[model samples]
Target: MRTFQHKVTINDMGAITIFGLGAFFCLWNRTNSLMVILGCLLIIVTIRAVDRAIHTSYVLTDDSALQIKTGRIGLTKHILLSEVKSVEKRPFAFHLGHYALIEMMNGSVVSVQPDNVDSFLSALKKRIEKKDNEV
Candidate 1:
């Protein structure tokens, strides 16, 4: 199995900024319970997002499947390699980070943000080829 780490991206930074704004708004509008609650929830989500990005990884299993895990909520997802039709890399304009769009045979696409695009793609392609040869 091959595993690759998830990279921190500008979107994550934007999320943090949004959470900060929410907190600021809550403080500005004092005595508003709903605003305060939303701000708190934002903070929790931001924290979990950052933590998940740092701790989570994309795994290519030996059984012709890809395993994605999120550390924040211990969430895991699996995708069969044979079902993957294509992988398109969508990079940021200035190289902040990239997302790979995995197209499935069912005409659904799943996007994954990983730290190193080459590593992720190479490993995925290798596994797909390996699985194809076995069949």
Candidate 2:
């Protein structure tokens, strides 16, 4: 199996900035119990997001499946390599990060964001070719 780390992008930074500001303001005011609770919740959620981002990775398995562990909420998804028709690299509109759009045989597309677009594409293409040859 080949593993790739997830790169920290602008989305992550934005989340931290927004959440931090909210939490800071809420805690600083010390207005009411509800606001304090909400601030605490935001802090917890932000920490969880940071932790997930640090540990997130994409795994291309030997069984012709790609395992995705996204940083957001620790979501995990699997896509069968055999079902993939093609992969195209798409850059973010803001030019912050890169994602690969995988077109499936079922006419569905799944986008995956990886740390290194070229490396991820190379590894995925190699696996797909190997799987194709075995069939």
Steric overlap count per candidate: 0, 0
Residue runs of model 1 more than 4 Å from their true location after superposition: 24-29, 93-96
Best by lDDT: 2
Tens digits of per-residue lDDT, candidate 1, 30-59, equal 687887787778778777866776788898
Worst 10 residues of 2 by lDDT: 46-55
**Hey, what RMSD does candidate 2 come out at?**
2.0
Supply candidate 2's per-residue lDDT for 60. Answer: 96
Question: RMSD of candidate 1 to the true fold?
Answer: 2.1
Model 1 gets an lDDT of 0.83
Cα RMSD for candidates in order: 2.1, 2.0
Per-residue lDDT value at 8 in model 2: 77
